[model samples]
Structures are given as C-alpha cells and as structure tokens.
Target: MMRWRSRSVSFFALVILVGGCTAAHSGEPSSEQPAAADVVKVSTPDTSPRPNDPGLDAKLAPVVSSAVALAEIPAAVVFVVTPSGSWAEAYGTRAFAGTDPVTVDDRFRVGSVTKTMVATVVLQLVEQGKLSLSDKVSKFYPEFPDGEEITIEQLLDMRSGLFSYTEDVSFNETLDDNPGYVWKPAELLAIATSHSPYFEPGNGFRYSNTNTVLVASIAQQVTGETLGDLLQERIFEPLGLHETSFPADGDHTMPVPSPRGYLYGTNVSALQTVQLPDAQLQAARTGALFPHDVTELDPSWIWAAGGVISTAADLATYARALVDGHLLTHEIDRLRIESLGQLDETNPATIRYGLGWMSFGPMIGHDGAIPGFQTFMGREPASGTTIVVFCTMRDSPTGVRPANEIAKNVFRALHEN
Candidate 1:
C-alpha cells in the first residue's frame, strides 16, 4: 500500500552496507561478556573537538542529554561530520534493567532511514541500465494491481497513492497478539494490499513503508541477489564500512562495545510509555534479561523501509558519498526535486517530502524511528557538512525530535565555528 498525502502531524516527529557478502554475525552467545573498553561512558565532552567541528557538543549536548535523562532513555549516541573529520559520543546505560553502559558501535534498527540505502541501490540498478524510472510496478510484479498505472518514478517519489498497511487496524490487532512474530515480505504486503488505494496513483503523497518493501522485492528479483548482497557490491565495499549488516534473522543485538536498545511500546501511534497493554512487554523485556538484549522483529517486515543497521562513522561516510556523486547523479537530482505535493498548505515555510528523504531549505536528509531506536542523517550540500544522531530510546509523545534538532544545532555550531 502506498499513501503519500499524510500531513506533517503524521510525520511530525519523527544506512550503509558492509563488505564481503557474509551472513551477518549472530548476537553474542553470552550476556555476561565484558563490555568493550572503547565504549565511551558518554559523560565527558569530546576531548579534541575538531576546529570546524560544529561544536554540536557545545550547542545541543545539554538539550539532548537532558531529554534522554528526563525521559529515562537507556542510551543515546551523537555523531558529527564535515569535510574535515568526524566524531561519535555515547551517553546513558546500555541496559535499562541493569548497570551496563551504552557503547557507540551497537546496532539499533535505522527504521525508515533504510529507505535512503534502498533508494540508492535501486538508483544503482537504474544507472547500470538494469531498470528504468519510467518502468511500471507491473513490469516487475505482474500480479500487483494497477501496476501499469503506477510508475517506478512515482513509487520512488512517494506519489503512489496506495493505502499504507501501517494504517490497518486489523494488522495492528494481529501484531498486538503476536509481538514476537517474524513477518515475511509477502505477508506484510498482503496486509497492506488488503485495503484499497488511499488515493489515485500519482495524485497525492503519503509516507508508506510498503512502497519501500516493494522496491526491495523488485530489486532482488531483477538483480537475482538479496538487497544485502547488492548493497555490499555497490555501496558498502567501495565505502569500506566494517560494521554494517542486514541481519537475515530477527536479531537486533549490536556486538559488545555497542549501545543496547530499549523498545518503549507496541503501537505505532502515541509513544508506548510504561503503561499497561503489557503482554507485548515480555518479549521486549528480553533486552533486560539477555546480555545482548537483541530484538526479534523479522527484517522482512521493514525490508527496504527500516531493515539495516550500522555505526555512526559508516552513516556519515554514506551520507557524504551520496552527496559527492559517488551514487547516481541523476537519481540524486530526482531525489532533490522538491515535492510541492506533500508540502504543508498551512505553513508555506514547512517542508514537503522528497524521494526517500526530506528537505529543510538547503539541508536535506531524513529522520527515522522504530520501537527502540531513533536516527537522523542530514547534509547541508553546499557547505559540505553532514550530521547524524542515533539513540536507543524512542521518547514518548516527543519521538526523536531532540536528536534531530541536536543534529541541526550541531551542524550550525560547526558552520559558525
């Protein structure tokens, strides 16, 4: 289902591949393994803050730290990068149920940020002449209804008006009944397609995870490789990312020396505070009992939408690579073309969506949230600076706005410095 007309109130809140093509390493066997020494305690400010470094530390550190502390979020990670260099800082305990400290390298779900990578991979195929933007969805999947009417460009641009399954109440009911269930790609789609189109294709804009899932499936079919494999071949290997992966199974554990993630609730709507509706709580509570505290959401549920995980360094590199023409220049152009369709009619100063990303003036990127994670990656293209923030806690009501805002301040501070 693809629905792209949702309002800012709907979005209101709220990356890289590794080389070698190996299956992702499984979560650590024991919970008791000693935490790595390099995992910074996150209390102290970065010692050698770079000269042009946006002094993001000086600008938003207090604000972000206060939010994380006030909300009782288990862990938070901030990363800042420019043409000159990059640095990562960590804060809070790794485990909410215990005393372990959070680490920088830990893997949390990147959520919709995964769309950027998925879009990149698709654009790569387009560049190689394997696919074309004008191609219709029916070209790849004949069974898809109204495929001929829905062009690949529309899908990439979020102009496809299919109903998002995420809005399905029945699907939410089933998810509530089985919080630990691992969803397959087809299964997830079936839920969304069960509903009719939200609006005529190409008439409006909505943020639909299903559009990304479909893209991933199509890419796999055309390339005859898993999305993970393609990412390694096209993006990760060239970039030299040592710690990124698409876990085939539902494991969410980052290796030792990484921050642990904590999921606050079950529903996609309002923040799932510590209140009841608590049966879904046990599987989540596993993060407390196990040392890795890994999660079990089937990667297929997110597919291209929110699947992969990586470190702050890798994310910054990927963002820089995207802007530097390392990825497809034309597709990047397509991404930058502002979608007046999704703009807030009430506030002209507010943003409209872009292909797999968003634009705030000259600053362009996207922010994402899953149960236990919130992340943002943005770049001021003309200035040649990129900012990224990742955290383990998804705040109630507030979402990841703090990390996103901190990233903005970080960039401004660095620019001013």
Candidate 2:
C-alpha cells in the first residue's frame, strides 16, 4: 500500500542499461525449509481475465494487455487464482536492453512489501509472548528521541508522524551521486528525526520508511536474532519457499543461475542520446557506494521497511498463509487488522492498510518497488484465491503507475468473474 511520491517528467523513448556487478546477497535455506510435497504447482496462465463476464480468457487478456501497453513496462509477470482455477503468465523480457526473456521463476525486489513480512514476524513474537504490541520504542532503542511517545501501534499505523528522511533533497542528491552508499540505522533515524513530525504521534497518517526501520530494529532486539533468522524459523521454513531470502548487504547479483535485472539509464552524446541497459545497476548501487554486499541491503536503510527479495510463487504462497490465518491466530489477527486502519485518505478504500498488509476489497496484501523492480501479491481468504505479480525495470518511458493499476484491475477482474 506504500505509494511512490516521485514521478518522471521527461520521458525517454528508448533507454539503456549500465552493466556491471549486481549488488544483492543470497543465503542457504535452513533445514526448516518446507517439504516439496507442500509446495503447490503454479499453473501457467492460459486464459485472459474477464471483467463483467466469467468463462472468458480474451476479456482478461485485454485488461492486462491494455495495462501493460499503457505503462510501456519492459517486463512483467502476472499470476491469479480463484475458486475455479489459477492462471499465470510472463510478458516482455527480463531486460529489454538485452534478449533475456522473463520466466515464471524469475526473482524481483519486493520493496516495501517486505514490511508485511517484518510486521508478521513481530506480531508472531507478540503471540509467542516474546513481544508486545503495546511496547514503546523506548523499550528497545532508548537512544531514539521521543521514543516514549512512539508506541509499536503508532509505528505500525505510520501514525508516529515522524517525518520521512527519504524526502530530504540532500539525501536524494547524495543517493543519486553514491547510489551504492551503505546506510546505518542511526544515520537513517538522524535524517528522519532532524525533520519535524508530520503530526502528533497516533494522530494523522503519513508514510515513512523510518517507521519500518524502527520496527525492524526493535524486532531484532526483542528476539535476540536477525529478522531473517526469525522469518525462517517462523514463516519461510513453515511454508517451504526456496526462492525467498533477505540479504542484509545490498548485493544485487542473484545467486548462480538467477535471473539478471537490467536498469535503464540516459546516455547522451553529440551524435544522439539513447537509453542504455546495465545488468549491474544493483551491484553498482550497493557494492560500490554502499560498501556493503548486495545480498544483504543495509539492514538499517530498509530495516523492516523494504529489504525483501522473493519470487512470484513464494510471494503468493506467503500471501495465502497470511490471509488464511495460517500465520496468525485469531486473537492476534485482530490486532493486525486494527493496525491497518490509519492509512492516508487518498488511498482507495479497497486498500485499507492493516498491521502489515493492505486490504483491497476481498484481496488483502502489499506491493513493493525499488529502482528496477515492482512486485505485488494478495489473497482472498473467503475464496482461497491468491494473486502475485512482478515486473522488472522501474519507471519506464510510460511510467510506473501501471503496475499499481494492474494490481487493482486484476483484483477487480477476479472478483467480477
């Protein structure tokens, strides 16, 4: 449910990608990985989605096609399911600057969607009597200013009113210059706290990466373990997601045989200005400037806020668990639902941001985006349906909004049919 505030003004008819090392990390799945028998077979998409009518594949294709066409997205993958059946499709390529076609198993950055996982882990701790929703930030990070005023609930609701450090013009400038710069939790908080609060804590709503960062830090402190470890112990292992991992460093290269991500950049010369494609955009940003491994993003930068990488199948599997109460007991589920109530009024009602996931009509989940990728997934618990979509290359010539539009359109189409 986190929306991007930035927009592109100038459009490049064609773009180029700068190639080099990828900055992302990968780790071995623990012994707790789920059994193969539990993993459901993800069916290939055969029919297009229908809007008002059911039993029509052509109708569904147009909706998805128009959305992709309008967005001019370089690459996209979509999967949807309902009581009747499931369908998944891959469109475009992994990198338009190159000839690599996108496959069903390609991995993509989940951006803020990682927040849902972090929130779920934290809530699980609460259910285990290891953490408390009412706990104050002061309990974990006594150094943070006004920690007492910021409760766990406020942080989850984004009602903490803490100004976002991402909005700092200087931060953006530095980020542009040193795309690989590593960030620390304290540094990120200082940037955020330096600004005034958007409103009183627990009052109005404003989205800030700071809230999730704090949540991540707090979760680690309370559990005496890395967020990644906690996730494996509870969710990933239980679900048996082979492709999901949280690289603390910002390494961009996927493990051996992983799909390559291409970033589009502007190149100008006397002869002509053209877009270039670089497979190493992620590595350059994380390894070179950040001085951190690509596999593990500075845990502090995204903290619990946005550092998560997952496959489309894994994303759908996780969403199904979250919505169906496989992860949260009924008592704790109520708290999570309550946390989503504080979202900004501008977002759609279908999008009621709960503790971690966003509710869109019957669909409940979150979406993620970074510089080169966009991801989203949701589940309709009542109908036992799950939808997961992923796209490579962020902010193309057309724009990034199409990804968002696709999520909504897909949800509506599924419901109507």
Candidate 3:
C-alpha cells in the first residue's frame, strides 16, 4: 500500500500554485526504433477518441504534457468528462527507452482506488442486512486487538487505528527482495496484528491499509465469496466496467497494450522517502537516468487494499457512476456521502475520508498508489464532472504524485475557465 503524506494544503489552494505555470515542452515523440529484446513493445493504440472539447483540450493538454515531462514520467493518460463535453488524451512512450506511445486504453494497476470498490461491496452487504455499519470487527476476527470496539464503519473510514502492514519493515524488505512473492490475505493481516494499534478506535484518523484488508476479510466471511467475485457481481458487471479487474494473487502480468510500470527507487527507499538525492533528481529530470521497470512485480501484497487494474476510460466511468449512485440504493448512497469527516481537523478542506472513499474539494472518489503506478479518479456530483489520471511512474523524483498533481491542475483549469 502506498502511504501518502497528509500534510498538504487544500486541493484548491495547491492547484493555484501550479495552474498558472506554463507547460514544459520537452520529451517529444522520437523516431521509432527497435525495442530491446527484453522490452515488451506495445504498438497498437486502439483507443478511439472520445468526444472532444477543443477549449477544454486547450486547457488540459498543456497541463498534463508539461507535468509528464517535468516529472520524468514514462507515460500518462488523462480523461475528463464535463457537462459541456469529454476529452481523453495520452502522453509519452510506453517504455522509457522505447518509442511506442501509450494509449488511453492501456491498463495499469489502480492501487488503493480498489478500496472504493471493496467499500461499495461492504455498503451493499449492509443494505442487504447481511452486515451493519455498527457491527464490530471482533465478530469476524476475535483475536484482533481492540477488534471488539472497532465498527465496520470505522474500518471503512480509517478510524480503526489499525497499523498498516505496509509500514512493516520486514514486509517492505520482502517486497524489495522478492518482487514475485504472492502474498496471502491472512499473511498480510498477521503482519498487521503483530503490531499494536496506532490509537484506540475512532480516536484519530489514520489511513491504514490494514483497516481495508480487515473490511474485505469480514465481507468475505459474511458472503462466503472472494472479494473479486463480489466486486464483479455487485459493481463491475452491473456498471459494465469491463476493463477493470481484481486480479488473482498469482497474476503479476499487466494486460496487453499496457505500458510497463516504473519506479525510481526500492520499496524500502520509498518507505523512507520518495524524494531522491538532489544529484540523482537532477539526473532523472534531464533524462540521464531512468526508473526501474517493476511492471512484473506481484500486487497481492496489497490485495483488497490496492490490487485492482483498470484503464483511464473505465476509471472515469466508475468514478462517475459511483458518485451518481449507480452501485447502491439512493438512501445508502446519501448516507455514504454524508459519512465524510475531516481527515485533518486542523486543515478541514484538505481532504475528507468517508465510508469507503475520499473527497478532494467537491470531487468525490479516491486516489491510489502502488509501486510503479499512480492513479486518481474523482467526480463532482453537482456538475457530473469527472477527472481520471493514470501515470506509469509512481511518483516524481521529488516525491510528488504525478496523477494527483495533474488532476488538481486539470480541476483548476476547469475552475478558471
């Protein structure tokens, strides 16, 4: 699980800082050349262009293109849907060393954005009377510390105080040393349980991946079905999100036409800090150094928490549908929306975590990060405006989330225009 810092200012204020900057014009498409023997070259750009808004494109294209170049990201895809129209565009190459351009259709891991889907299933179970928001976690995992006091809603909202397993040194070391290892849910839970809670239940808001894994486990125990099956039945199939999938634990390969995911440093290094040393950062910025291709690394370590794969189009569709109440009853959707509370009381407008998702200003949905991939999907319910961004590189050399940063800029563009 990618644990992001919660110290940033409100999205609107931060957007103002980057929105006025002019687009950087580096990293133009190079002449096609033969790919290295080991590199997987994706030649087909099969995505048909969605309805274009020339004015919207003029505002968005420069923002995303500039961000990709400045961040040294291998590739990125951005999709925006507004009342006026929709625009979808891709930027950069499929591989850092190759010439093939990425397409809007290319799939990549959506990471913690999977939490929204898992949370949706939990909410559905509640609506069906199979579970309740007030249900105690101890009902499912009797031995978990303070489980008796933790409610299902607390777990969904990150108020359970459960320690994130991804924060465990051993777990991250394993990820660095054995990228191919397939992690079991129980194993992940065990790592989390071995540690003490960050705080008593509901005392503080901590974004712990353990809370989500526990929720998924409880949901599985209640329905006697795997989470993937539940999502496919309840959310994906009904919404026709054909491009999204919760992959099996053993499957590490990304779908065809997908760009290989890249990362600047090892998991342990990222755990310490996503920022590279100054010299290395400059080298990366100038294209003298490239990120490591970790596209084949197993994602099971973050299953239920961050293991879903999807494309730009699918994410935009899901984001809009989720905000529009396509996956839940009208009453339940209203409750879910109202469940939001300030993630940081000191900075109320920064971001709010609700039942199973988060809100950035008026945009309701979630962002995700895993090794080699970063994604953001959010839709403002009032205007039916959706923004989806996918970046092949997990973060810029300075530790900025490329997808989230680009989405914020895009939002600012819309606001300004």
Would you estimate the TM-scores of all the predictions? 0.75, 0.75, 0.86
TM-score result, candidate 1: 0.75
Best by lDDT: 3
> All predictions: root-mean-square deviation over Cα?
10.8, 11.5, 14.0
**Pairs that collide, model 3:** 111-306
How much lDDT does candidate 1 score? Answer: 0.60
Clashes of each: 12, 54, 1
**lDDT score at residue 281, model 3, on the 0-100 scale:** 91
Sort every candidate by lDDT, greatest first: 3, 2, 1
After superposing all C-alphas onto the true structure, candidate 1 shows an RMSD in angstroms of: 10.8
Compare candidates 1 and 3 on TM-score and give the better one.
3
Better of 1 and 3 by lDDT: 3
The TM-score between candidate 2 and the true structure equals 0.75
lDDT of 1 by residue, 1-417 (tens): 443223221121110012111112222232322223211111211222344234544555665566555444567777766555555677877666668766565655677777877887787667667788788977765546677678776777788876676677766665556655666566566666666776878898877877887777677666556666666656666676557777664553445466555554455433234342344434434443222232454455566688778777677777766655556655545554444234332221255576666765455667777656778776666767667777775442234444565565555555453
Which candidate would rank higher by TM-score, 2 or 3?
A: 3
- Can you tell me which runs of candidate 2 are displaced by over 4 Å? 1-59, 256-300, 338-349, 396-400
Residue-by-residue lDDT tens digits, candidate 2, 1-417: 111122111111011011000111123333343245422233232223333234425546777877766655667877776667666667786544457777666777777888888888777777777678788876765445566678887787678888877777676555545555666555566677667678777778788888887777676655445666766666677777768887665553454434443334411110132221243334333343111112222333555677677777778777877776777778998777665555332233356766767876666787775555667777766667777777764444433444566777776665563
